[model samples]
Target chain A: MNALTTEKLTKAYSTKVALHDCTLAIPQGSVVALVGPNGAGKTTLLEIATGLVKATSGGATVLDGLEPGSLAALQRVAFVAQDAPLYQAISVGSLVHLAEALNPIFDRDFAIARLKEVEVPWKRRVGKLSGGQQAQVALTLAMARRPELLVLDEPTSGLDPLARQEFLAHLMNQVATSGMSVIFSSHSLAELERVADYLVLIVSGEIQIASPLEEIVAHHRVVVCAPGDLDGRHEIEVIDRQLDVRFGSHLVRTRNMETLRGLDSHATTLEEIVLGYLRRAQGIRVLEEIGRS
Target chain B: MDIDKDSLPTQQDHPSPISFGLDLRSGVPTYLQLVQQVEAALRLGHLQVGDRLPKVKDVVSSIAINPNTVLKAYRELEIRGITSGRPGVGTFIVVAPPTISTKAFDQLRSELVTGWLRDARGVGLEDDAIVALFHSALSESMYLANSEGSRSESDGDA
Candidate 1:
């Protein structure tokens, strides 16, 4: 069963639409990476899935078809927001105690042990700690709940390279031992390249691609050829193209390598794929603005 | 006092002999990278038959990759009949990969250095160009082999 599934999910605000008919399924036991340009509704989708925000139409379900924000779903799913909001005034020790007092399943021992391992000062105020330490403390609390599915919104945004590696290593170790699923949104494509197996690309509040990372990397090829070389290729699905006076580099998705046999093609990195799609989306927006004007 | 130290029970639990490193710039999938490392270790005699592979947790902690990727690599190795998992014990190298004899290895190396290296250098190919040309030739050969349908592993596509 899918850990999380949304069908025709839409969230529209008075000013702008956040998500439009967004439908996707995150399989159980897979580490999914949700990526998009800033304000592309990644946060909205995550908020809706974690029950923090209500959808305007359609719905989402988590863990055995439980409705998001329901008591059961809340118990089984843990979320860490982008900022990892914590009580700045409270000590780490106090926060741990508070979490234990509030949640029946909170594993205080595990949280304490983890915090100690990460060298987080239990006596210091949460606000006084470094950004990395705060993030770790937040993750420790969430993990101590032993939730079936952990959803994180840009957990490594402000972390240094070492801290980010340590955080993800800790997370992967937990996944190895506990077999819990994860869905995290990150702007760092290189970071996601190693840990994330599932990929979800959102553009302009719509889902552009959702598939296994392996499939996406395998199917997408970047071909640099003369301009107009790909004009009539019906089999190649051109995702994005950049043209220069000398050459045109086309990012095309095709399952058959035979189609690109004679082309100067190479494999694309995850960052390239994400940027290509985002560029295409921005181009479309520009064209729409031009037409309207 | 002729006790066999090699047969002692205490010697069996040594940590895994090999650790994995990743080259993300290589564009190889993470799991495939793990698989290739194991294969390379086996080929170089660094990992021997019956040697235990690292635990999934250990690999994940060191490499900072998903544990599932490690598991997938071990699974692929098992599928290839190169390794086998012993449930609670750990995965072990089951078969020794085919190795070239020392004589043939030396001869092949000498031939490459004398023949291909000389020709490339004679044409004013620099170090980077020589390496790039070698890799491109290797890839072309692999591609031809793939088209001939002799390579059984699907990892070549990646």
Candidate 2:
């Protein structure tokens, strides 16, 4: 069963549409990376999936066909929103107690043990803790619930490089031991490349690419050749192109390797692939606006 | 001069004989780097036939990489018959790669230094160019050997 699925999930405010007819299904046991430019519906999609926000149209389901925000879904899905909002005024110990009182599934011992292991001062106020410590507290509380799926929104946005590595290492360790599924949205492509097996690319409130990371890497190639060399090749879909006086480098998606014969084509990193798609999406939006005008 | 055996480190305290290191900037796939590291260790006699690989959880905690990458590398090693996984136990190296004798190693090193290195420098190749040339040649020959071996095996099967 899929961990989460959205069908025609659309959300619109008074002035702008956040998500538009977005359909995606994240398989069970996948560490999915949701990436897009700011205001590209990443947060909107995540909020809808976590049942924190109501979709203007369509719906999202989690954990084997349970509707988001339903009691059952809430029990099985834990979400750490952007910035990991918690009761800053309370001490870490109090926060733990509060969480235990609110959620029956919350494991007090587990939370305490994990916090101690990370050297988070439980006696200190949550507001007094460092950003990394607060994030760890939030993550520990979420994991203490032992939910089937964990959703994170920009979990590493404000963290330093070392902090981010430690945070992800802790998360990956839990996943290795517990087999809990994860879906997170972040702008850190390199970090995501290390931890995510599935990739979802969103642009302008629309889903552009959703596939396994390996498939994306295998199908996309960065080909460096003269400008005239690609004149007759229609089989390759050029996602982004950079041209100089002597050479043209094309980021293309093509299944037939033979089409790139006699050209210097190499595998593309996730960063390159995401940047290429984002640039192409921007170009398309510009063209559409021009056509409309 | 009394030494307490109980204070000394024990094998149980350090279960894994080998630890993994990752180079994210190497441009090679994460799993392949791990496999190559194990192969290199085996060839250098640093890892023996019975050496135990680290647990997936331990590796993930240390390296911050997806556990699937470690699992994939171990699976690849298993496929190559270099390691075997015992359900509740740990993955252990099953086959030791053939090691070059010290005399042969020394001879090969001297030949490379005197012949290939001298010839490349004589041709005015810089250090970077020489290194690049060496890697490309190595990969090309490995690729050729792999393809030709598979082709002949298929022919024999037919």
Candidate 3:
């Protein structure tokens, strides 16, 4: 199959298990976002796929031409590490040139122009620029590489809201223009709602779901009702809910939102869907007992 | 990831076969859109058997899809005998494509309709209510498609 497939991949850290029997088949050139909260193994999984960390058992292969860590693989697969590491003395312009020269797929003109679009100065040293600017420069290097699969770990971290928006817009525009696959993991759910095509939700060490981001949003919804009588009757575990006799709302997951018919609806987002999954994975027994009781 | 609408090459003729803005975000896949567009072309006779398909690259460039995705759709059409590929030359629609048997289209139709209906059903709507909603939604979509086609036609003429 000309796809990225991980067969029975397992990873563990001593007695602390992280990613148990996780296997996912991701096609080439599909922008899939890996999302989970802190310590959710999102970073660990990305690290293994990049060959920075070895799998405890099973394996991840990237098509036939590439193997994790094979120079060919590294050349083709770009990793925008959580915090872009740049030599403190390097200027943004020089780093761009360095990246362009090193990467076979580098599109310097596009990268330079994108930086110009963000109005981030080119001559600023990595150490001299603000945090957001550093993030942008890091992102610019990765995008310029134009790899087949760009794995971005917290690509938007440390940026203000506006810079984050700019970064996301640029990331999506590049994906559309280049047909490159991106696996971007972020804590920013609202921003993720805007650009993600696919979502991978991992909690504690297992992938609960991976599907088109839109599908996740569409399938999961929240229904608000005056809290009190309904809590006892909800068949599905409450993902997160607060009911002050004055007002109440419940976030829950169902394959279909048609179950939400009569409730006064409130907000629904992938963030909720993911958090609920995490909660269940962590306290699945408690949730089941609640439901059974 | 800066998508400069102006920076990318723009070769598509205006009033293209597919209109973007006219459609609602129906949450349908692009291949399905291409499938529906081809069917409409055949029904309207704007396209005929032996008509060459626009290059996969061209289709991908115009629509936000991967080249492989366009190829996949064309491959499905070819398997159905609605289209044929001349290796390196492009895909061409074959006249008298394998029996579309109205039923062939029905399955795809039901799938799309059910996507919306299934969600409504999940919310506890009755079958009759879901059916009514489907009709309303389908009519809305058809109206949008027609308006979009005409708008694009004028753009092409210009």
Candidate 4:
């Protein structure tokens, strides 16, 4: 069963459509990257999946057929929000004790071990620790529960480069050891490229590409076509097109290799693929405005 | 002198049959990195026919990657006839990599390599610089070839 599946999930706040007709399936035991810019509905989608927010239409399921937001489902899923939420007034030891008291399956030893592994002071107050330390503490607490699925929202946004690496290393170690399934959203493509096996590219509340990272890289290419030749292509989805006014050259997504025939095409990186989708989204917005006028 | 039995070498103490690694900064896809590592080991004679590969679980846990990535890399090796899996057991190196033949061609290739090294040295290129330069050049040329191949194939289709 999928770790999480959303079917045409839609969420709107008044007139602002946060997410629209979004359908995605995150497989079990895969580290999936939910990628987008800051305001591209990544937070809304994650919130709905965790049941922190309600979907105006459609639904999301967690871990084989459990209804999202249900107590049973919530028990099996752990969420580490952007700002790792913990009681700042309590000591690190108190937080662990509180977690143990609250979670039936909490592994106290494991939590303590994780903290020690990261060298987080057990005697220190949560309020006094650095942002990285607080994030680590929150992660350690969530991991102690031994949840079936872990969802993180821009987990390392506040961390320095070295801290981010260490954090990801710890998370990767856990995933390797426990076969844990994870879904994390991040704007940092390089980090995502390193850790994520699956890619979910979301732009303007829509999922443009969702597949294994290797498959996405294999199927997508950038073709530098002779000017005026790109207009007649209907064999593949054109994510975006750029015209080099100085050289009269056209750059377009090959979508598949079929349209790349007789054209100069090159393999693209994850960043380039994402930028193409974002550019295309911008183009569509511009067209809509033009039509309205 | 006192000798510790634990320090003694045994059959199991020999170097592992297969050692897999990846460079996250290498820009090569993870699965391809795995495949390339195995192929390099085979070509360098570090691995032999019938050598057992590390279990999928071992690779995943040690490297902290998704299990499917290891599986995909293994599948690619299998497809190339370099390795085979035994279901309940584990994957094994089934054959040595194909070797280059023809002494004349080898001599010519070695001469070309020597000339390139000489030219690189003349330009005051260090070992790392030489490797980087070669890799960049190869990738750039391969991209040109790749696009050319695609263009021809599409033309044929049309």
Candidate 5:
């Protein structure tokens, strides 16, 4: 079964559409990286899935077809929001205890042990802890539940590189042992490149790309061809293009290698593909404006 | 069940505590890095046939990477006929490592590569350009040889 599946998941805030008919299925056991530009509805999608906000239209489901934010689903799915919010006045020990009290299946020993492993002082108030430490505490609280699926929204944006690596390493260790699926949204493509086997890219409130990292990298190519060489290829879609007097640079999206024959082509990296998609989306908007004018 | 370390050959034959030794900052894809490291270890005589590889879970937990990445690396090795997975047991090395002897030949090969790279760099050729040239040359020769062999076979049939 998929860890999460969304069908036509849509959301709007007054006049602005946060997510538009977003349909995606994230397979179980995948460490997926969810990425997009600012205001591309990444937070909205997560919020809708977690049931923080009601979707304008359509819906999403978590582990084993449980509706997001439902009682049973909440027990199986853990979400650490971007802020990693915790009660400021509560001591770290109290917070851990609170998690145990709230969740019937919470692992008390694991929580304490993880905190100790990270050297987070149990007596210190959450407000007094460093951002990284507090994030760790938050993660421990969520992980202590031993959920089947974990959703993190920009969980490491506030962390230093070392802290981020440690956090990811700990999460991966857990995943390896338990076979839990993780979906985390982050702006750090480099970190994602290392940890994420699957990638989900959102653009302009839409699902731009969602596939395994290897497949995505394999299907896209940066081919430098002559200006008129790609004219008749209806099967190929150019995601981004740059033209010079000497060469026509096109980021072509296709799995067929035969079409790219004799062209100076190279496989594209994740960052390059993401940037190309974003650039292409912006270019389309510009073209739409020109058409309207 | 995990592979029994005690049942394996001695340390001189196969290195204990097998590792991918991945360079996360090197910008190579993680799975490819894992594959290359395994091949490199085999080539260096650090891993031998009949040696048990680390379990996927162990690599994932130790390296803090997705299990699929390790699986992909292992799958690549399996496709290349270097390793095979045993049901209910861990993956095992099945193929013998290619023997590399004569230190003088190794040094000579490295010297030639270094000198060729220096000349290429002197000509303002980038690493990518050098790789592309080498790859094209290799592919062209292989393609020509395959076609020629096929033609000779057809002639014999006729």
Candidate 6:
């Protein structure tokens, strides 16, 4: 079943359109990374999905069929905003109790057990815990509700590599154990490459690409060919071609892979491929063209 | 993930566990590497039939490899009778192929190497010379990436 769907979803921030008539189906129990450059409307899209921000046009649906922000929907899709709002004065137990108090579906024992797994102090207040620990507590509370959809916004922005891994690990473990679908946004291609199943690559408030991660990595390669070897090549589309005294190749992204090896070089990386798509969407495809669709 | 830094191990931070180069980088891709690794592990007896592999989520978090990639590998292996996946119970190694082993990877690699051999012979490159050339190119690529990394580190981000 499509756990969430946006039908021509559009959102505007001031005169600038933050999202322009985007449409997609997100299957149940899958993880989607809403990827884009900064200000690409990823945050705007997530906000609209959770009904924190209303869409200027179009509509969204959650679960089999439901209003985007209705209480039933809200109860179904729990959110952990990038700036997780936790009461500093409330102890970990108290904060969980808050969720228990607020959510009829709250699973208290599971929440406490989750905290125990992470070594979170039961008696300590949110203010006393480290940034990571607090984030973990907030996460426990979010998961405690056992919502069908969990959306995390720029979840690991300032986290060090190890902490980021742990956070993601815990998140995915919950996903596996609970069969919950997750959609989070991030600007980091490498991280997303390693974690996400599906992706929506947004650029300047438009959905540039949305597909399974495998399809992406399957296509697109960076081919390095000598200047003369390019031969004004019409076979494969090149994204970034530059001449160098040593490497003699340009970074490129393309769906056509056969011509890549024939171009006299190797393929690029997961990160470069993502960057190439973003670059193409911004520079080549006009925003108006995206909006019209 | 918003977590304290000290609570976790620095990435690959181990003095180095017994790991194959299941790289998080490269579009050559994680699942292919995973397939290769598991196959190698089986041949070396590092894993055996009926042994439960790590939970899909555990692999995703600990190694930080893409879950889709892991799923792809697992699915393909199961199809090939190299492994079996039982929903909710995790994946397990299949000691014996329910049928014949295709040895497709071996055949394909051999065929490609043969083509490379013919090309080198046509181009007057010998076996040792070809081997050296392959190593040199691999090393060059590695060097370029590392050099590029250090240069970026020094230029301004420092």
Candidate 4 DockQ vs. native: 0.19
- Compare candidates 2 and 5 on lDDT and give the better one: 2
Q: After superposition, how far is residue A235 of candidate 1 from its true place, in Å?
A: 2.7
Could you give candidate 1's per-residue lDDT for residues B1-158 as a string of tens digits?
23664454332468889999999898777888888999999888899998889999988988799887898999999998999987766899999766679999999999999999999999999999999888767765654554345223344766
Better model by lDDT: candidate 4 vs candidate 5: 5
Q: What lDDT does candidate 5 reach at residue A106?
A: 97
The docking quality of candidate 5, as DockQ, is 0.32
Each candidate: fraction of true contacts kept?
0.73, 0.73, 0.00, 0.15, 0.52, 0.48
Query: How well docked is model 3, in DockQ terms?
Result: 0.04
Q: lDDT tens digits, residues B56-101, model 3? A: 6555433434444466678777876788887655577786444467
Kindly report which residue stretches of model 6 are placed more than 4 angstroms away from their true locations once superposed. Answer: A225-238, A243-262, A265-267, A280-293, B1-21, B64-68, B85-90, B96-158
lDDT string, candidate 4, A27-86, tens digits = 888899999877889989888888899999988988987887889988999999988878
Error of 5 at B70 (Å): 1.3
Would you list the C-alpha lDDT of every candidate in the order shown?
0.88, 0.88, 0.69, 0.81, 0.83, 0.74
Query: DockQ for the candidate 2 complex?
Result: 0.43
The TM-score leader among the candidates is: 1
Clashing pairs in 6: A132-B3, A132-B4, A222-A268
Backbone clash pairs for candidate 2 read none
Over B61-103, each residue of candidate 2 has an lDDT whose tens digit, in order, gives: 9899998988999999999889998875678899975567999
lDDT of each residue in A46-100, candidate 5, tens digit only: 8877878888888788875888889998888899998799999999999888889
How displaced is residue A57 in candidate 5, in Å? 1.1
> Which ten residues in a row are the worst by lDDT in model 5 chain B?
B8-17
- Rank list by DockQ: 1, 2, 5, 6, 4, 3
Candidate 5 wrong stretches, greater than 4 Å: A243-246, A286-293, B1-16, B24-27, B48-52, B55-58, B78-95, B99-132, B135-158
Docking class of 2: acceptable
List the TM-score for candidate 2's chain B. 0.59
> What is the TM-score of each predicted model, taking all chains together?
0.87, 0.85, 0.58, 0.78, 0.82, 0.76
Q: Tell me the tens digit of each residue's lDDT in model 6 across A120-167.
A: 999998889877787787788889888999888888875777777788
Give the Å error, residue A249, model 3.
Answer: 6.6
Ranking by TM-score: 1, 2, 5, 4, 6, 3
Model 4 docking category: incorrect
